[model samples]
Target: MTELDEPASAGPAVQLALRELGILLDKRVWAPGSRLPGERALAGQLGVSRSSLRQALAMLESEGRVHASAQRGWYVTTSVVSEPPSILKSFTDNARERGLVPTGRVLHRRVRPAAYEESRRLRIAPAAEVLEIARVRGLDTVPVCFETTVLVRARAAGLESVDLTDRSLFATLEEVAGVRVLRSAYSAHADAADAEAARLLGIPVGSPVLVGEEITSDQEDTPVLLCRSVYRGDAYRFEATLHRSPD
Candidate 1:
């Protein structure tokens, strides 16, 4: 019987096959569209069961290669493809799409006198009533950022009754509360992590961190989300494309 027709097996053989595959990938041992040797062929060559080879390929598919179709056998990826990062497709959408899980422990959310910075960010009088929300957000169970969000209390009345934990705040505002977030302008800088930011992000105090501030508005251009977020430097990477002018 051929390798394709061979019986399945498990364990150390499975692991070895996978290890060899990894080395091959690192070396590009198989070019794009290269058909791996038939299962029986590989199993015999690797001294493993055909079943084990199949299991190894299954794992590869999960890693974004080795596409399998109904009638066609597995094939190496012919295109440059990567897991699209999680996106905010809608307020109700999941952050996990971009490989980030949106989880937060809410620290504070109440109408209080605005801080001097909050007053300017939210365009309210100094000490004017505003909602101050502090949270430590996680990605894949790892703390990646700490946020202190301030909003115009008068503009977002009834927030005292809203539960803002372990869920997307932007979703709650737009979808559940009927408020809108049109666009936000962001400014980012590098800073040394303070104790609070360090503790929340599981980093050492004085470590490099990313400080980002944004002011969001509504369809009518009324500013809405005014918040600052400090992201851990080691765990976060933000990429963007830009056009440069000729010298």
Candidate 2:
């Protein structure tokens, strides 16, 4: 029998660790509406910071795992997948807090001249330098997205300076590199997953995918990330709250 490679852990520490309590409850560690242990107690049992512990609890609350009574604390919310998308406020932290393993492996990270297409979109000088990063991202060991990102290297110098793994793309840009993403335009299309995508996505060749292209800009209106992401349609659902005035 072939052994699969062990997946990456969320790393050491309680607040940031893989507090599987969320998934555990999903897998029936506790029934619906069951009251979980208290925060201080759970922090003690898990050997983590109260903040980290609270993060997990917050995720559970978001998913309906626990509810809060004024004087009391949170209790169970639901049994099925109540976890929300990472796009809410701090999606990355929320997803991690809920025990949904998020991993990004660099397929290629390099510095290259901007492509003609990029030059046209970013309005940069032809042959301008840009940072290119491609990653195969997974959710709980399931490959679900292929992210190919490009950025203008001049406006934001220090290309290839920080660790891409173990960090959020936008966070690293905003915090370490001082390149805060301010605006973005995204467009999605229906396409088939290629062999490389299939290998990463655990699906048959030519599987359906939502090809999303996004161009993110800084507060100064300089382009930050020109990203092309192929997300597994089976693994993702885009949601929104559309308010319509009653006719």
Candidate 3:
């Protein structure tokens, strides 16, 4: 009989199951963001009771290694992608620096007249033409962020025709439009995923997410692009270095 078959005490059974589950996760027996086996099958394979397996899974969940859905069973958590806020880098650059394959899928693209809010954000006249693009971004096939970007159409002539799939917007701007983004003003907050964000990021509606907004500027400090992003809370981390101000 296996050690977990029928332990004299529940504690040992739980510990054994936890160890087994940890090993599986460490070895990537299940890939990140992939659903785990059902509790019954997993419990039987580990020779532990469902209750014991549940306790182990709970422990893993607390450690950010797994997550559970109300009706969809358990899933392996995606690896956290960390970015330092002090540096300015494109998503593609950051992912490549971490040895992850970056990917993008453009969801929506159009040229439209800028509304009051859009013009205010982009520093353009109301009703001016602007290019709007929405995309889903991922690393290693795990969707992590949904983003929307808008810019004055005149800044990037023919930009609407560029195929942005698997391409970096920063690179495209430099190569196709001779526009270089030099800096940005950014802010973020904790928010619940809305229906649209949930659908794009593949998370349940109301799941915790990090929402960010940025205004990018050219060398002359002219606001050239406005971007908004929603990032999965479980899959992304923003790091910053804090320092005390001089007296």
Which number leads on lDDT? 3
**Candidate 2 or 1, higher TM-score:** 2
Ranked candidates, highest TM-score first: 3, 2, 1
User: Which prediction has the highest TM-score against the true structure?
Assistant: 3
Identify the runs in model 2 with alpha carbons over 4 angstroms from their true place. 1-94, 97-99, 241-247
On residues 158-205, what C-alpha lDDT tens digit does candidate 2 reach at each position?
658777774578877787679878677766788988888877766567
Per-residue lDDT tens digits for candidate 3, residues 1-247, read 6634654458988998999999999999998877899998999998888888998999999999999977879999987777676877888888898898999999999999998998998888999999999999998888999999998899978689999987889889989999889898888899999999988888889988998899998878888899998999888888777789998
- Model 1 per-residue lDDT tens digits across residues 1-247: 5545445565676788888877876676665444566666677878767788878878887886665544446655432212123322321143465544566788877778988877787777899987788988765455667888887777776666787777777767766556777677766788999988877776668867878777877777887768888876544444444668997
Model 2 lDDT vs. the true structure?
A: 0.66
lDDT of 2 at 131: 89
Of candidates 3 and 1, the better by TM-score: 3
Q: Against the unseen true structure, what C-alpha lDDT does each candidate score?
A: 0.68, 0.66, 0.88
**TM per candidate:** 0.59, 0.61, 0.84
Kindly provide the TM-score of model 1 when superposed on the true structure, using C-alpha atoms: 0.59
TM-score of 3: 0.84
